[model samples]
Target: MRMILMGLGVVGRSFLRTLIEKSPELRLKYGLNPTLVAVADSSSAVQDERGLDPKEILDLKVRKGSLSGHAREVGMRGVELIRGVDAEVLIDVTPSNFKTGEPSLSYIKAALNTGKHVITASKGPFALEMPALIEMFQESGLHLLFSGTVGGGVPFVRFVRKCLIGERVLAIKGVLNGTTNYILTRMEAGLSFESALREAPGTGLR
Candidate 1:
């Protein structure tokens, strides 16, 4: 699978590491030869028509902050770069901007316009521009998958959209804040909010 990665944060770095570790199994079992064609952050990107070295990129990213810090023969910024790549799939894992969806939204739209399938974890573009994106992807026979958008791996959207396809959705209400829920759970165990927060590893959905 020829793919372009749009972000190199915690999730992106982990994805790269896991992809490298599982490449052999992926090819042997699933007959999928995954290749990292391009990698980008908010600043700049590195592209190789054949494939970029994932380890090298990851190491550079770890040493030097953003992708632009890496010494490169080629690089580009903004949505124009998305259109320049020749890849079958564009992985959009950039940070979500529920309010604006700026670069990520533009990147997804531009990639889809170029006939590349989009697989996004960002909820901003998908939540705000779903109608338009779905229309465009459907028209072009490409996918706009947002499997990791909400509630972590809870499958909340799938359960509502797929499992309850025929049923009507009247109201959606629940404790969406994992941090608050965790704190509340700890509070029940006689710990205060601040104590719970300090005890917890990191703030979630805050």
Candidate 2:
């Protein structure tokens, strides 16, 4: 399977690194070969139709802190990357704009239209446009997966989907936001709200 990563932000870069390190084991378990085809950011991107070197992509991200140094075979806007790439999978890592869902929606819609299965971390598509996106994906015969939205890396979604297959999940609840839990902990443990909020990483409440 070939993949195109549409963002070079902190989470996107980190996920790529993790996948690269564990890809051999993953391939063995899934009985499939996975390849990273393209890496795109707001400013620039690296595209090699054959496949991108995961190590090189990681190194470039480390050195530049974004995908700016790589050669740009396509000069259109970053959003167009999803439409033009030939990869079977498009990973939409663009930051979610809850207000309008501008770029994220545009990218997701374009990828679905182009017949690529999309796995997105963007909140707008899942949180707000889920029903419409579900219909679109079903109509197009593609998948629009948003595993990163609800659990925020807690494995809650996978647990519910895989383990609770037959069980009816009437309602779901969680301390889904790690920042909320941490802040509450600090406050209960006798720390200031300012300090607790400050402790949140560069991504803030996310």
* Local distance difference test, each candidate: 0.79, 0.78
Q: Estimate each model's TM-score.
A: 0.80, 0.85
Residue 42 C-alpha lDDT in model 1: 71
Span of 10 residues, lowest total lDDT, candidate 2: 69-78
> Model 2 Cα RMSD, Å?
2.6
lDDT of 2 by residue, 82-128 (tens): 67778888888888788877677888888877888988778876667
Instruction: Kindly list the per-residue Cα lDDT of model 1 for residues 62-105, writing each as its tens digit.
Output: 88876765555355765776788788998887777889987689
Output the lDDT of residue 160, model 1.
82
What C-alpha lDDT does candidate 1 achieve relative to the native structure?
A: 0.79
Each model's RMSD to truth, in Å? 3.4, 2.6
TM-score of 2: 0.85
